[model samples]
Target: MERTLVMGILNITPDSFADGGKFFSFENAIERAKEMISEGVDIIDVGGESTRPGAARVTEQEEIERVVPVVTELVSIGANVSIDTMRSKTAEAAIGAGAKYVNDVSGGLADEKMAKLISRNPNVQYVCMHWRGHSNQMQLKAEYEDVVKDVKKELDERVAQLLKSKVSSDQIILELA
Candidate 1:
């Protein structure tokens, strides 16, 4: 039987909707990751940026500074880690630091180079989540006639783009959220 894997979110951001800055500090983020592992989480998804509505985008350098160290610490502690980032640069940095997955909520749309980056790192897994737009403007773009159909179509398109970019099908994981 196939068992469901439990993935825990570890937001290393000051304005995360889930944790509300509880894990923003480096030490706090690492502690939370360890706690999640002890609590039976199979994967720790580390996100440095907040996607909360009307949230301003953080600089790439800031995001890298926020995420890479946490990912490295989690990997050193034998935890399976996924970098939750839209920018390819951040994902590349995290992967270099030993993260095994790239969780892009934008389905590779936010960053044009995301697919190419994932393609080059064939060992890394990519989470292509369905995103209508950025948090600040997504609600305004949510007027789909057939939500399910539209979402499916969009995801398919993304998968095709990824394939064209040479990212293997096995490396891609489709996420509705």
Candidate 2:
């Protein structure tokens, strides 16, 4: 049987769905990453934005500032890190800071540059999730003839775009969550 790799979640924002405000501080976030590493986590997903319903949108600069430091610190400590963000700028900063992956919940809908960015960074893994829109109004946009078929179709289209942009299949990680 194939072993399932564990990816630890590190929310550095004050309004995440769960564990918000728990590791909002840089020091706290680092500690949590360390703990996860010690507990055998294969990857650490660091997020700076809160995508809950009605959550406020953070500026790109704010997201960059909130995540780069933590990502840098985590990578320095030898933890495999992934940046949980949708914006290309944020993903670039995180990759520059040593993150190995981009976990974009918007599936590239939120940022036009995302697919191209992932394509450019051929070594970085890209996690594209099933998303209709941003969290603030995604639920309202969830209409579909067949949920399963529609989601697969959407993801396939996004994947095709990524491929056209030169992203390798090995570097793409589809996220159903």
What C-alpha RMSD separates each model from the true structure? 0.8, 1.1
Model 1, range 1-59, lDDT digits (tens) per residue?
99998889999889988978999999999888888899999999999889888888999
lDDT per residue as tens, model 2, 48-166: 99988878899999999999999999888888999999899999999999999999999888999998898888899999998887878977987889988998988999899888888
Each candidate: what lDDT? 0.93, 0.91
Candidate 2, residue 4: Cα displacement in angstroms equals: 2.1
Q: TM per model?
A: 0.98, 0.96
What TM value does model 2 have? 0.96
List, in order, the clash count of every candidate structure.
0, 0
| Candidate 1 lowest-lDDT run of ten | 47-56
Question: How big is the positional error of residue 138 in model 1, measured in Å on the Cα after superposition?
Answer: 0.7
